[model samples]
Target: MTRRSCPCGLPETYEACCGRFHSGAAAAPTAERLMRSRYCAFVKGDAAYLLRTWHPRTRPATLEPDPGTRWTGLEILDTRDGSAFHSTGTVEFRASYRGGSLHERSRFERVDGAWVYVDGDFLS
Candidate 1:
């Protein structure tokens, strides 16, 4: 049987996929979830949710999802245990657009019983 791929790159279903994270299911069991939600937030243009889920220390006071960027999809490549419930995770994916594509490896951390996005490294 062909394996269904997660738009977020994880080998999971859409229902069990990033939707779980966006639906507020534990803000992702690891850093990967945070990264997915952050991506979903961008796709949906949910700046408020993005800001709310971002780590306070690193979270910008204001977030402006790039208007010119049109995110096509997501693909999570690999991940590791950052820590415990509070862990670190990495996601490598490509976001396509009218102009070009953006490849990024985003980082996330779990803090205060919640997952928050810390930062990301542009791979492209």
Candidate 2:
């Protein structure tokens, strides 16, 4: 059987990497893992997973992945305090698309023992 590499840029197959989290078989153990899975969700256009991982206070009523955007790659630039011992963290990343890239520092928080995206600051 053919194996699909994870869009999150991990060495493991999708099923072993972000897919595990996406399928509810396991939860991301750390903030960086959650960030990677969220990136994978965006690439796969999995709005349900995205919404499920979004902080309740910041989560929108609904979400729709942009079909027009073609995601190419992800680069994790920096991270702060997103560890198992920390309740909040920030991830700085650059997500590349077809024509351009998005640079942002995203904030995350542990909600009910699961990491959830809170918000982000766009960077120049």
Candidate 3:
């Protein structure tokens, strides 16, 4: 049997991995998990979930993903805190797309017991 892979490059199927977060069935437990899910959201163009998981302080009123951008892969480079025991952290990752790629150091923080993406620094 061939198992479907998640866009985040995880061995688990989308349903078993990032789908739960996309569907709002669960919340990401750590910075890396939240980062992976956000990458998956970009792949799926699930802007609603993306906004919902964004920190209210930084979330835009609307998100319009570029139609031409096709996300191809994600490589997590590093992480700090943002665990169950910590309230804030950062995730540095490289996400590839059709024409080019994006390297970002994303920030996250737990608000009201749920992880939310706060912001990111675009890296070259």
Candidate 4:
């Protein structure tokens, strides 16, 4: 498969964008970055990174990336401030895939100075 632009909405290539976080080269600096990396993880099937970055309180023991889907694009809708350093955040986005489309409003939390994805609500 030919590598394509990141579905996370970053201008950089996947390898240079969220790939850094997936490869353990860096930590996501903000809730938006964490959200982007998680999206990239889905695109690349980087389950380990997804598991690692997910907030333990809400994370599942395992994930099965849907093989039938081919993700085509992402559009971020909104982001807003949340709680304290250990706080809450939100990311609303739309993702298009071969099978269908998804609109989600994901919730996030900061724990131990790192932003971690907690959960999301499917809006579409």
State which candidate has the highest lDDT: 2
lDDT of 3 by residue, 34-99 (tens): 999999998998999899999999999999877678998999999999899999999999999987
The alpha-carbon lDDT assigned to residue 55 of candidate 3 equals 97
RMSD of 2: 1.0
* Residue clash pairs of candidate 4: none
* Residues 26-106 of candidate 2: C-alpha lDDT, one tens digit per residue: 999888899999999999999999999999999999999999999999999999999999999999999999999999999
Q: Please list the C-alpha lDDT of all candidates, in the order they appear.
A: 0.70, 0.94, 0.93, 0.83
Tens digit per residue, CA lDDT, model 1, 15-121: 57766666666456667666776777687677887888888889898978888777776666666664454456666667666677778777777777676777878
Model 2 global lDDT (CA atoms, 0 to 1): 0.94
Candidate 2 Cα errors over 4 Å, as ranges = none
For residues 1-124, write the lDDT of model 4, one tens digit per residue. 8666667878788778888899999888777788888888888888899999899999998998986678887888898764345378998888888878899999988888778999999995
lDDT of 4 at 8: 87
Could you give the C-alpha RMSD of every candidate to the true structure, in order shown?
4.0, 1.0, 0.9, 2.8
Give the Cα error of residue 23 in candidate 3, in Å: 0.8
lDDT of 3: 0.93
Native-referenced Cα lDDT, model 1: 0.70
